[model samples]
Target: MNRPPSNILGKGWLYCTVFLTGAAVMVIELLGTRLIAPFYGASLYVWTSLISVTLIALALGYYWGGVWADRARSGLSLIIAIAGLLTIIIPWLTGPVLLATDPLGLRLGSFVSTLILFSPSLIMLGMVGPFAVKLSTATLAKVGASTGSIYAVSTVGSVIGTLFLGFYLFPVVGSREIFIGLGIALLLLAIIVAYIEHRHLKSAATTIPTALLVVIGIGLYPQIANSNRAESNESFQTRFERESLYGWVRVIDKPKENIRLLTVDASTIGAASISHGENLLAYQKIVTLLPALAPEMKRALLIGQGAGHMAMTLKDYGIVTDTLEIDPAVAEASIKFFGFVPTGKTIIGDARYEIRQLKGPYDLIILDVFTGGSEPTHLLTVEALAQLRDLLTNQGILALNFVSFLDNGQNATLASVAKTLAQVFPHQQVFIADPDTDFNDFIFLATNHAMNLNDESFPDSHRTWLKQRLVNIDQSQGMTLTDNLSALERLQIRKSEHYRRMIIDLVGTNHFIR
Candidate 1:
């Protein structure tokens, strides 16, 4: 094995370059999810595409990098620098690419978007490992040591990048800014390595103009992102937007109606009209009426407190409600923008884990957890329903809110959930909040004992609505959603597509501008 001239950059500098490039690769991978989440949702398919593309790109880069390292020893720094520059450019290009691909629908569009924006940069970053190994090995005897040292350093960098970006940097800075900063840092490192190796003034001269151009581009990003937002409908103004651990949370305001809506990713989770003090969403109002259906209603467990609309309604009805929300930012935004006062005890954690820890024989338990228009399928499995059944009182009702088509043959998610509930509870009743529509809210009410729909405790209007919208599901045609064989996410692909289109229609575009 022929080694390059001993005058090449110091081993320390080479190791540092490998570490930084490794960190950048992971950062870009994580940010890619955030980039496409607002449009396609961070679904299983979306994640699978992103991860698979990244690994494939890295594999290709390793092969190409090793070949290049042997053929052209001096070009390693240039390769790393080029990769860094490309990574920087990706964030800027993402908005346009998403807009252009909006017509492709979710599955195909998400795959294409990740492939276009993430693959090239990742492939380049992957080259750092083999390139570093080649440059650091001084002799045949030291090759093993050199390779292990470089890989260990690179892995450490990946761990730091993952933890820091996820826990700190992502929450404090905008995703666009983070990408720009990472790019600038990587570019500077590349320039430094080139100057160290060759003592070339021309490398510095070339880097100055490129750095300035990157800065200028960073300055223009806000305007470009804003222009992208101009494609959305101007009817509603976005009052607040934040990327949380759960997903993208936005509080949109309809000034004319005095309505403030809380949307997670592209799906509207909760809404409240300032003019009406109570809940304005029809589904929310329906859930609140659960106490009326049950004989006793003292304590209630409300899972997934999006904007706290249902929790507030339950509290107003004299039920001591305990709310559980996975994302703390959501609960904070709910109180700040959506008039959610923290009257009840709010627990911040995953509902599945928290539900198991809680000791409950409550009158009502409402499951309304949805992120990016899809429910966490794990929470809808047969085992989950059985756990929920154990928490309910003997005559207590378990109410679930699901969005699906209710036209008999078109409602797989709804029917599957109903069938699963029947397996645990003796009686299950389905109510379509808007029976006339093709796609609407389908509320499922389940209980161990038969529910008395004729209970005069319910308001006459609610009773009338329930009678009109009740769906008689034939269990023979539906499949139970189990932990091992849950198809809720797959079955709801059409609804997810519809959600994308509906958002595009509502906002006049499917992409997230901010």
Candidate 2:
């Protein structure tokens, strides 16, 4: 069994190792979501998989660490060194692991991919806490205090790491860079611990080469990943890519099809034609037609400024529009690539919070929010609908863009949304963008008064299509989602899974998964 450190400096170094390892654990857990988001999406299932895998890995590590601490002569250096190596190799392992697990479907695929990619490093990091507790304990009497102090320090590290990554690092740093930097830090930490313990550079002979490998990996891996991304695929070409807190924001252009798409995670937010810079999405067209529903529509509020298509569309009709978009990266991409100029005041925040902040009596309030293959449950609740209702004028129209099946077989989530909306605006009319399929972009136009459309200005095709696909939603078909209780995430798992698969099928997986 190992003896406790003899000096204060030695003990301090040991505790530092514990702190860094604790931080690394939380960082890896959060970064795992970003890594998988491009391919599998940051869906509810993906989060569940990563979270569940992290807990399991930690549990196993805790048990193994306690046993090892009692039996082994060294402290946490070797475990940390091994973990660092595994962490460094994650970017390399990610592509292969995702490819192999792709056939497992979203839930199982994401769970298995996370297990394969993160479990080993997490298990090693988990060993740090128990080992630190063991190494710091001096006597049987003081063991309790030592354990408590060490754990408290570790928890503090975790808290700091969570805040740092979420608030700062996520927007600026790439996932691979963050992973490599973390791995290198851990490696250097292992060396420090070894030097403190042995009082010579000789003890770190094994770890020195491993650290060098991590350095080389950091340099070479990016080139390899970039080369793969730059592969000559005739189907599509990636024009822009940025990893943000919201999702993996990408602008993919299909020259053959003459389309440019703005995709976040697994969902395409907007698409524009290459030759003409016009928005090519059916939902955007339907939304543009919304102003015709209210001829005196002077002011509008657009939630989810996706590529700023609908916002720009409203601006074209001489309406003063305010936009609420969460991701700054998305806003940047929309303007730089899609030629979207913000016509009015643009607020960069979540819809729920920003909606509360707005002092609006808007004639048109559009709800076109979607993230990670599903609508945010918090924004779709009855309480959220009430907020939107309060913001609208008496004759104002609230047009919601939703993706779900119109048929009874797979329409539970859709029905729930319809039910929630009806609670606030009872007079609602639903229209399908594509009548050929059950799963289509369903636009719900809600108003306090009876719905009437002035088709005089609209083209013959637009007028005919609008009249043909008008659908009546059965509001009592599902449960009401509210702030107190929400099963929207649970109810949307299957729908999200289907949506993910459809995206993969439409655009080949290499652009995302690789």
Candidate 3:
């Protein structure tokens, strides 16, 4: 890579082009995920598929362009012209493709969404390199040098793109606008590159096809504006559809008790409902139903808050709550759909990361990180439990949600998790959801304080619910999953090789969660 050559673009222009192209690639790749993720779940599988398709397309472009460059070697003008086309087309197509991706995302799931939504744009992105090298090629002997330099530029561009998108672009401007902006930038660069080379336009035999393509691209722009129009139910009261780095957040206003928070990837989190047509600020936990559950409980934190469900619920119970959630889209959705109001102190980074970052002296923390079968493995580890413990005051408690099936009701994962919790906290008790209520779910209360299942501290409603149910422990069929608990004990085991493999595992191949 360091081998010197008879450089043509020189240190200045060459470096500039490399950074620009590299930035474009990174923008397209990373931002493309943002573009698609708004419609689909921003799961690792989705990322794997998108990145895979892009890499494959790039390899094909490399091969084809390497061969084509031999003949098309002297046309910097042609290269720029095509790049320009890409710029225009990409912006124009943004709305259509993303809109087209919605129902398609639903039908195909996140995996297919990645392919259907991003493949074409990624392919277009893939073709940029070969043409750049072909246009810049000075001599047959310098082919390697030309290609290397262009690629170096493209990579640097990518690094810039990544930093820009992650830190500023996503947090500030909307995702749709960013897509359009990048497209325009690419188009201008292409035209500029062509003129800088002082070359006339190439005579294309198929001008009509080219014209049609441009027209089609121009038509795609409006799709961006229209893709975000209204609620699926056609309710006039619904207001917004915003896209973020994580996914889309839509707000629907109805004469209801709470605003509904919907994650593009999962089920609804919470609803912003109205009381007597007036918005109520009260949290709806109704924790008073369980005699054992207390309102004046110590400091509290909620992980994986969707529209501030647990946070608001706990807040209703008079517990000081802190929330940590990964997606900003979800946070926005909470304000837009659910009546839950957060006090701006809610952490916006990845939940686990933010939890580690916080200066915690919390008395209670709610663990709802499990996205059903796709629970975060790291959070279930002993180390994570220990960290949570570290943040807890002496009497602090952790409320964990464990899912269970209604049929014959046996949960290996919950048992395993319980085993781990027992290791962490000696004073722990479990409150299971009604067995016949369809979900064999349980909420494990872990704290240093002696919690009384029959304590007078329970709210009247919670006490009534607890009074009707009997506490039964299934010591027979279960595994307490902990950091030390090996996967072999479960019926399913993971042998994943990469992100793609892990996704497949999430879908279950004799794996317990699938």
* Each model's total of backbone clashes: 1, 0, 34
User: Per-residue CA lDDT of candidate 2, range 351-437, in tens?
Assistant: 988888899999998888843385587888888999999999999999988887777433777788788888888788888888888
Q: How displaced is residue 257 in candidate 3, in Å?
A: 9.3
lDDT of each: 0.77, 0.81, 0.55
lDDT of predicted model 3: 0.55
TM-score ranking, best first: 2, 1, 3
Better-scoring candidate (lDDT), 1 or 2: 2
User: Evaluated with TM-score, which candidate comes out highest?
Assistant: 2
What does candidate 3 score on TM?
Answer: 0.73
- Candidate achieving the largest lDDT: 2
lDDT of 3 by residue, 1-514 (tens): 3222224444454456557756766676676666544333454555676777668766775676566646653343344334435544443454455455434433244445455544554555556677666656657888888788878777877877889888988778865567666665655554455444432233343243434444554566676445433224422244555565555555544433234324333323444444322223122232333213544465677887766756655555566677787777777767655655874367887755777787878867778755332345667766788889888877677777655433343445455666677777887766656645534446677777686656665566666665454334453455555555534112221111122233323222111010
Model 1 regions lying over 4 Å from their true place: 1-10, 140-145, 200-234, 455-460
RMSD of each: 3.2, 2.9, 7.4
By TM-score, is 2 or 3 better? Answer: 2
- TM-scores for all candidates: the values are 0.90, 0.92, 0.73
TM-score of 1: 0.90
